[model samples]
Target: MATYKLDCNGGSGNSYKLALYLNCAGLDWQPIGVDFAGGQTRDPDWRAGTNTMGEVPVLEVNGQRMSQSGAILIWLAETTGKFAPAGTVERFEALRWILFDNHKFTNNYAMHRFQVSLTAEPVHPAILSFLRSRAEASCAIVDKHLMDRPFVLGERPTIVDFSMAGYMYYPAEETGFDIETDFPALHAWRQRLAGLPGWKPPYELMPVGSSPPVRVVTQTA
Candidate 1:
């Protein structure tokens, strides 16, 4: 058995976050595909047995399950000491970014994407507009912050980068955001991240659909 097993839905950006970290860290991990579209995750038995929160990207180590990408990323950082913040100040900074990501960045962005591209049912325009506005505001904040830095913590990548990068790899059509033009600085930072060793686009790292993997074109060019 792999040292760690990740229960993931290929369509979930949250799942991509943990998978990215594991791959980049060179951890001995396996991706256990979850049939989220089939309503498996929401099944009572699955929720009680896997995650009461009813979420994917549940990390299992020695049969002990851990959910929530930010918490799992922190644990992995502390355990591997690979992408951990270097100092107390950096640690707090990392935490700040991580919280912002979960609350504003990935949260709104992922919701907007699902409504716009993934959902089989039509989403109300008012709802999509609300999510889009929130996502754009969050992207603007991070873009401005990253204007002068190579990574979230300044010169180096941290777990915060991994957290924020969750949905950035998906196609612009799916995300409904032209990050390259709308958030130039953020686009550059994403390229820097993609340049890291062992980096792979989300679909390539998980079992998603029969559709071929969309080539990730970093907006740097």
Candidate 2:
């Protein structure tokens, strides 16, 4: 049996964060696809049993459940001693970037992608504009931060890279942002991280076609 079991939705960048890290680290893990569009995660039973927050990337290790990609990444880094911060300052920097990623980076980016590509209904133009602005802001900050660095922590890959890279690997159409064109520095950083040994794309690390199609309900008068 694998040492870890990850329950996640293929389209979820949060899930991809953990899944990608596990794959690149060459950990013994299994993927359990979640049905996000089918309301599987929203089910009371699931919420109470798996994750009280009703979120994806719920990792089960040694029969213990863990949630939140940031927390899990920290734990994994500490436990495995790979992709870990070198010392005190690096550790603090890593924590800062991870928090920034969760707050402003992946948070806005994933929300914008959901509105633009994942949702069946058309989102309001104003909402789309708001999301886009926030996402762009995060991108600009990270791009500038990585302008002269090889990785999030100056030299080597770390958990912060995994956190920030969660949504970057998805198709341009889905994300509606051409990082390679608009943000060259960020794009280069992504490529550098992708070159890590044992690295795999999101879909390859976890099943990507698990979410059920959105169904439309008709009302009879």
Candidate 3:
């Protein structure tokens, strides 16, 4: 059996995507909590040892360190012999959508959510409008791609679906984008993905003044 170490912040969508995939794959791995609220990801130890960029969902598999949620998802899927198609063309297609999600959808949504919605300081009107517009355009592209397929790869779920789902869902909730209202196919895809075995939401966003959320610890034997 291969042992893996996953360093992550519990509430982050990217972290949840990896967590869900690991669970679904029935892999033996350890989940090391990084407290984003306390800037634990920026800690020297985590940055040097796990991710130089200090990003969450960094996976250490058989002593090889890996970062980036989409890359990790592809690695896990290929390693576990699940969630990826067999043919070369099919696999390439899956990879293309995965890249699109990371480069296109996630980028725009992050700018809107973090820079505009979640910040303490006021955002400039021009910048806010630009981010929102970019986010909407990205979602429209996703909506079009998902129109005929239940998953990004095809009829069945794949690493691309798992990798993109969390990022897609984040904007829907944080930005009040209403994906279900605007894109029925994509909305149904979300519902289908959520119904999969071992599916779980990342973590509930805590209300103001609430106690800190409980962290889950995983041990690899």
Off by over 4 Å in 1: 208-221
The prediction achieving the highest TM-score against the true structure is 2
Q: Write the per-residue lDDT of candidate 3 for residues 1-221, one digit (tens) a residue.
A: 44977777545667767777776666776577677767767789968877899777788877798998988887777778878666899888878887887787877776666654455565677887788788888888887888887888778888878887765555444554677887677788888888887776665321111112332212100
From the highest lDDT down, the ranking of the candidates is 2, 1, 3
**1 against 2, candidate with superior TM-score:** 2
**Model 2, 1-221: lDDT tens per residue?**
88989998778889999988988898998889888888888899999999999989899988799999999999999999878888899999999999999999999998888777767876787898899999999999999999999998888899999999899998776777889999999999999988998777877777743654422322100
TM-score of each: 0.92, 0.94, 0.84
What is the C-alpha lDDT profile of model 1 across 148-206, one tens digit per residue? 88998889888999999999998887777899999999999999999999899988888
Candidate 3, which segments miss by more than 4 Å at Cα?
171-173, 204-221
Spell out the clash pairs found in candidate 3. Answer: none
RMSD of 3: 7.4
> Candidate 1 at residue 179, lDDT?
93
Model 2: weakest 10-residue lDDT segment is 212-221
